[model samples]
Target: MPRLSGCAFFSDKIMQAKVDLLHTGAEAMFADLGHFSKKAIQIAFLSSIYPSLVLTYAGQTAYLINNVNDFSDGFYKFIPRPVYWPMFVIATLAAIVASQSLISATFSVIKQSVVLDYFPRVKVVHTSHQKEGEVYSPEINYILMVLCVGVILGFGGGKEIGNAFGVVVIMVMLITTIMLTLVMIIIWRTPPVFVGMFFIPFVIMEGSYVSAVFTKIPEGGWLPFAVSMILALIMFVWYYGRQRKIEYEMANKITMERLGQLLAMPEVQRVPGLCFFYSNIQDGLTPILGHYIKNMSSLHTVTIFVTLRYLLVSKVDQRERVLIKRLGPRGVYQCTVQYGYADNLSLKGGDDLVAQVMRCLKRHIAMSTDRRSSVSTEEEIANLEAASLAGVVHVRGKMRFYVGDDAGCFDKVMLRSYEFLHSICRSALPALGMPLQQRVEIGMLYKV
Candidate 1:
């Protein structure tokens, strides 16, 4: 009786450790929510996936019970001899489809991370014209492929890989549970008792699995932990550096009055055409424009300070996409183009952007109450039309950031790493479809 009790305890622990790996599909489905509607995922899972999984697990358990002595490769061996090969082929295809879904979800997550300034910029290819969430990242795909190959080579067996996967999946579930609890309390405004009702059981269940899997860390579970730490460090450094850079820009930003004074200088020349100055700032003039004025001493007839901002929503209406505000200086306008995560600003051949800008300018002119007279509005519209005819010039900044002399060792290392990542990653120009000949890159270096 004592020996049977001990065996049962050992079997329970083994089952707890391996159960997370089985539920990995559930976590993966959540990750893929961006690619599909919430209703679609919920219905598919409840109606089809849940039933199928329950039946499959029941069949496997029954087979294991009948053949208790045959423990080695029980899953595959349980299948009937006639349909074994066909089932194997189907399982392989299903795995490939699941992998593809996970890959797509990864791309969507990375793109969101970039927008939120938590990661360095990377080339994101929108795979579908209509579905903005369907994206592919060549660089990330290659990185994932290399890492998968490395893991296969390092582990060299299914058991070890399964152990690592189980550890990571359980950790992810625990984190999700914690996040959901916070959301319930803070965002959903649920009562403490209700929150505890959902939280306590999950914490206890997942916490036990966490302890069970910790024993497997030395066996093969350390791989995911190491990889996760490295990625977290990268994200931390990128986010910190980006915040510092933004602070520096805000502190040194050129105001409209300062820009007006610069343009009024005797050496300054007002040339024909429209100049689109790209900036991260939404209101004030960018340091890049100040640099340009100081060096070239030239200004366009009509200048538009352009900033692209991504909102938290999935889509922004086309009618409300472009926002134009006239600045203190004549012919100076702030053009903000707003987009949502799942919104695409298709600037095919760059003509779409130019046309949109022209339309917004005309609308602003018509709506301005401060215009002295109808003649002034007409003159402004004519000037914009003439500038459009003269051609549009896109002025972009090529910026480099360096750490300050008084920075700590950690700050130096992080900033240096961020600089390296920035140097290699793709910029925003290519994605905008800006013409090469019309694009002008002004170089600026900042010590922050």
Candidate 2:
């Protein structure tokens, strides 16, 4: 079971030594030891094959002889040359094979970690992997298959396809460098002084080299530009749509105050007490977590609560801000931290944020003035009652018993505040399937 944030110090003391032992043992057995030697050997074998073929085909024997002949005949007297343009072609093939192997291996490691939730997901696998830990990729394999077939079909007929591959790849690298620099400024929050010192100079140098390469080889530019444009369009549509959906979800959730109140409940206090719960407010509170918390019957000393803000915006400034407060036993201090990003951000490796929160809970409570509006207090209750003379039940705050299917305690708590939700839906819609003002009507229920 996950330990509560407050008492985790004790748990950590007891478990740290064991955890260290396991980590050291795993490294020795799996990372440093010869357990993965077989895989390495396979990688080496594949890397070596094409390079050997390319070298051999290039007439290494004749090339050496020609060099010697040139030196002996006083350079200018060297007239005859053995044809080996085929070697250039072979070398290109060899380079492509080598690049693919390396790319596949890197992505394979990434893919395993991502699917298992050991790390944040990225576009590591363009295709499939056969085994859980295998480095082979189906995407790479298919791409290779297509290239090989193309090579066979266009053999000696169209070298442009082969030539285009290298040129386009270089163009991609240049574009990537530009994108990386921009990302560092926007996402990394790197200081402008350092960014200018490093970024401006590096861009100047790299951009010049990239421009020179493209100018020297114009065909490379057009093809890569076309492909890049297509990819940019796809990404824009995908990311923009996703951001809108996430925003819609967060806006409809309970206020930050109620969330903090929920964390203070007796049932919520038993589990390794989480101070804050960050989710895509639309996901609301997870029913499973709520059920476990409600069932836990222990008391914990320290806690910090959170509700994460995951938003994808074109600009980072559009991100949400955090709200923090101290609730003080049975209702100690609590905080909410919010952040925005233009892309998906991972929580791993971000340090012990909850620990920092625990300290804030003990000493301070910094939240927005707007928080009171979101949370329902005694005044809100009277207003709610006045608005509902149709005998609508008005439940508010920690004392309220949320009514919903035991969808789990967390979700139930969230749904309870939405009591007017179902009524509103019934009054607004004529039929379940019928259109509702150009809107896609979801159920009043919020499921995590």
Candidate 3:
């Protein structure tokens, strides 16, 4: 949707309309309308109702030869071959471009959904050097190609394709209409009478179209339903399965007070430099950290507990980018990095993200050491430079899942699909834009 880019156009709607239409044939019509309200209604009618009426009339009067017949070959048969061939090439190119846009948009939504923890991840490779979100997915590209082939082979002709396309568009409209009605009551809290006035008729209109679309299922309409259902199942399984994993982690999570007490032990040696522990468990001690301590018997001089949190926003400002909370003593700190829906954590200048966290850590250390004193900007920058020179490393646990014999059918199915999809997705390490040598992965097993 152009909702993110249409702010200026919507802000000065009247001016926009004038510039687009005042010098054209609509200028005389606008003049005859006189007032803005009348002109607005006239423009809306011209754009929507008038066009539909004109199209219907044109189709009947110019193209239709009979009252009951609808044929896919009719239009091409009527047109001269010379004119038909030229127009066909042009339309084909336009359709190809339109299909490109649709596929890109779908992949964009899926990529963002993965970041938002609503879907399983896919391999997203940047195709554009200058644009942050210009990504290409091999998996999606091949899948779309196969589907396109299937569609071409399955459809009898343009009629079936048009039928399928119209059905999808109508179904989309119906879904949006229902969502708008809920938004009116839940988001805007609009009065029920007013909500009914705006939404009811539109919903009824779209619902009817959708009901009609359902009638075509026996005639090439079942493909979209099958595809959508399968995709929806995959998405639902990934989201709720991950949610269960998070719940499991939280249920067995070690509290901060206990973590601090463990760190305070005399035998816990502090090694030099920063060790970045990438974790999903935000507040508690992660199994990754527990496993590290159990094996190494020593801690880093500076421990950065990094948690990448994606916000519901499209883009976040640097001011609200990172939240650093110092947990008790022994160089332990939690650095929560916030990213927006459109943000690329692995893009160019990603080093600045880690540097920002380092700067925050330095500032926290200075403030805590002084008790009542504060860290100056100069001192913080100096500390960051120092820490950068010493060294920094990222540590993350790669979890392997298991369901016991007692697990029910639903649990087994969900977890099996979750692991299968998880294997295909790019793990957080490679997706994080960190140097390969600096990133360390430890294997972890979680039983459900």
Candidate 4:
């Protein structure tokens, strides 16, 4: 697939700044939470609750019917009470909670763009904040409360309300799964092969389970499935077109040798280190050097920044992070460096980017050097200090979308994208994926 630059954005200002270990706010947050342990806890909690609730609801109607049949037919006929009503109620509640939470979380996931300014500004309250007795969504809360009161008075209980819950739950799960896939690809920089092999399959399987339930349920169960399918179709078309549009916009900037040269210039010149380059590409192909260079130049070095989110799966090709590709007289392609959307640091939660880049670049260069070696720590420090004082360079350009309207969306997308490229330039070698070049340092040009 051809990659596209969303727009044209470039700058030529350079700042000699220090580089540090902490790359972005999210990284800092993950670090502060002590990393894996916090994530493990979250995964564990979600795993425990999600499947249990889904399964509990799936067989509920069947259990209700079997128990009702066991009771005397005359007893139910005379008073008309189902033996499994209680179980049915409990199962319905469980499903609603799980599915409702899923829907709310979908909103949160999309809201990240809003937080990142990829979308228009809107207020969103964190659920935890509301749980602590804060009036977060006053309008929504009051509307729900009043409707619930109306239902109680009208039906004596939630019989009518309960009937509609199953359909709502199923619709939400399907929609959420679809949304999750899009988010993973667009924002998280998830590889298409991995997403297709592992993630999409799981979603299809879960959807099948939900589908079976809808097929078997007695009270308008199929309604939810129909709605989910309709919504899914609409979203699929919208998202697919959007992606195609973005790619078309970014096409001119996705050159292989050009990007490789951009990465090499700062390091090869050794002109005080910090350098920042920006591009208006949505895919961050510039951020991901391995994929970009491999296709363009056929020079494979250890791709220190290979997308590692799917390392375990087998069918997917496993290229080492550090693949050494020869450039003949140009010398070995020391580091096949590419930076993309995910690597962009400018979108990080409010950070002093210039200072952060300075610190990060210094640390990156230092991490490679051994103090006990010939170079004294004092001298290395002096060099780093001098580099920072020299200031980094910034390159900016006006990216014109090769396709579609020139609304601000194109510029907004590209500017943020370029900023991200700058951020990656500011930071150290990426920590995940294929190993990066040990012999060469990808210098950052820091700018404020």
Candidate 5:
């Protein structure tokens, strides 16, 4: 039961993952196309095909004199040699296509999880410049390859893998049903009676699949559980440690007066071009900015502290996605970009983030009535254009953990585990879609 406890991962692990409305709709449309297309095919022609296939299978089962139990053998017995061979070939092609779809879905789902911050940063390479969605993750790919090799070694045949796959498919369906019921009662406010009407049959159907596959745990069914548990452990540990770090940052951040002093300091000279100080913190400057001004000894002409947050809804309106607030007169701004779990970030399709930030800041400047009326619209645009020509840079703080000097034994152990897990997690740079040359990463060590 403890090992099987990984069943919880199917839902809980994906809780942080965003499911955008457009992607959801596309998936649903394709699902419907598959479902009704099959239904239509059955109704129009497969009705006859089904009866014949059933008879063929039944006849093979009935024949005690049957030389073989294999489907190809069965087909050879019932159908013409040439026709049976082609049928087998066609079936194989169909299976490969189906498997390709599954593989593609796996990549997309994991990428989505990374976006939603469920997983740590991983290398995501766009395989096609023209096709925005065509991406490849080497880390996930290698992990999958190893797992598949292990599965082939353990299962020894496609039939065993397929049997386990059937169990997983049913389990996912059951989980989807359970989640749907909750969504109905909560989000959609469906009546209890209607919820019961929708889920009862599925519960029975999927529960039967559970029974069928539960016994096969010893027969390679435990593969997914093992894999999921390992993945879930890595995911949760990274997320928990990162959350703790952010909490630390929030609790110990510089006060408003202190931040004002730092920004207005004589050493904080405004250089040409723009700088993006990326942080999860919404209030008070991230400690890294303090480090930057002290160590780097200067600030950008335009410094916008950008924080990306996930909103509760499915998608934020394009106009409302980026919220801009000018913090002080030191060319500092706070830009919080909100994205729904299911919504794509504004930086999608190779959009220039620096340009977007400038636009948001311009909009803010235009709306503010308290600003001096001396600077006209043309001048404001010219300043932005000048900065755009000067180029842009992204700055992020990378934190490492150490046990606190006054820490207890438990704290030391916990900090050790945290650092170990954190080390294995992906770096933020690759995930942020920032070019290596333009990105500046500042390191900070936290005694936890």
Candidate 6:
């Protein structure tokens, strides 16, 4: 009776382990969605991969049933001896391809998060000129390689590694299902009954898998949980710190009245050349502008406040990419360069940005209907041409954020972590293709 009970318990464990391993293959099927179209992936999986997987699993089960002693390493044991070497080579190649796919997917996810301000800025290299989504981040790739090595060394075997992988796979599936349900209800306006119908079965199945995996926590499942929590905390700190910095800039923005007063100061000199002041806010002058005026007491001949805005769409029309608006002061304009998530920043530093801005300025001046304004088309055009002849200077603010003296320890630690990340991550200006000689950075401190 005791032997029978022990056998039953082992059978149950084997079944659950198989369930955990099977889901990983399903997850891998969609991992390279960034590299291929959804329709192509779905069609391939449904027609070829799914049937192949089903047959392979069925054959393995049959072999195991017939040769119970070969249950250990059944995958290899079931293979015919004559073709074992070929099968092993094919499996090794497949594993490499899968790893590459997952790496590409990781880069795509990180790029999207950076665009949406959920992650710190990193150097992203577009692997394909035609496909914007095909990206490779060296920093992330190195980190992943290190972590993979460490995990392999620490776990020392497939069983413990499988425990960790199973937990992560189940959790990801559960989260994805919940997100899909929310999208169906909120975005697609699907009926509640339909949403529930689509969600409940998956949740129940995944919940069972989750329970099975939780039992492996002491073995190796805790690794994924720890790593995920650390990453989530870093992302949270970055998002929180970014929001606070934007709020501080908006609150301390220079008003039109104050700008006018500063411009009217006799000590202030209007220097020749086109100066582009980078700003976060679209409407008013950034605090960096105010700081520049207070220190140098000089303004550019043609000052353009440039703001880059990224939209959620895949691409924006080239005709509607740049929006130029005349601000209160003469020779001062605001140019908003809009880009979609999939659009490339093709405007290089020297003549490209200048030409685009000039074209946009000319269009804006010609389209203006305001009669009270002092914009003379010919004179403004001449001044801009002369400024272009002189040179273009890009002014960017180097900002540092710190917590207040009265802040709690959590705030201090979070802000400090954000600062450290910001220090190490790639700067926004360098990515713009701006030349170091022409770029000017004004240091500023903010108590967020």
Considering every candidate listed, which one attains the maximal TM-score?
A: 6
Candidate 4 lDDT, 381-427, residue by residue in tens:
56546644665444222222232354457545544444443333212
lDDT per residue as tens, model 1, 27-115: 66777776788999999899988998898888888899999976677789888899999999988997887878878888998887887
List runs of model 3 lying over 4 Å from the truth.
Answer: 1-60, 66-72, 80-82, 123-138, 154-159, 264-268, 311-320, 340-352, 368-391
Q: In model 6, which regions exceed 4 Å deviation?
A: 1-14, 128-132, 311-316, 340-351, 371-375
> Residue 414 deviation, candidate 3, in Å?
0.8
- Give lDDT: candidate 4, residue 212: 41
- Residue 315, model 1: lDDT of 73
Candidate 3 lDDT tens digits, 291-387: 6776777777767788888665666777678788776654567888888646666623845667677656666655555432254546644644565
Q: What TM-score does prediction 1 earn? A: 0.90
> What are the lDDT figures for the candidates, one per model?
0.83, 0.40, 0.68, 0.39, 0.66, 0.83
Ranking by lDDT: 6, 1, 3, 5, 2, 4
Clashes of 6: 0
Write down the TM-score for model 3.
0.75
Instruction: Kindly provide the TM-score of model 4 when superposed on the true structure, using C-alpha atoms.
Output: 0.31
Candidate 5, 334: how far from true, in Å? 2.4
Write one digit per residue (lDDT tens) for candidate 5, span 31-110.
32322345665464356545654675566666525555553445357555678788788778855655555555567667
Q: After superposition, how far is residue 20 of candidate 3 from its true place, in Å?
A: 31
Stretches off by above 4 angstroms in model 1 are: 1-12, 126-132, 311-318, 340-351, 372-375
Per-residue alpha-carbon lDDT of candidate 6 for residues 185-208, written as tens digits (9 for 90 to 100): 889999999999999999987777
Deviation of model 2 at 36, angstroms: 10
Better of 1 and 2 by TM-score: 1
Candidate 3 displacement at residue 35 in angstroms: 33
Clashes of each: 0, 17, 0, 66, 4, 0
* Superposition TM-score, candidate 2 onto the true structure: 0.33
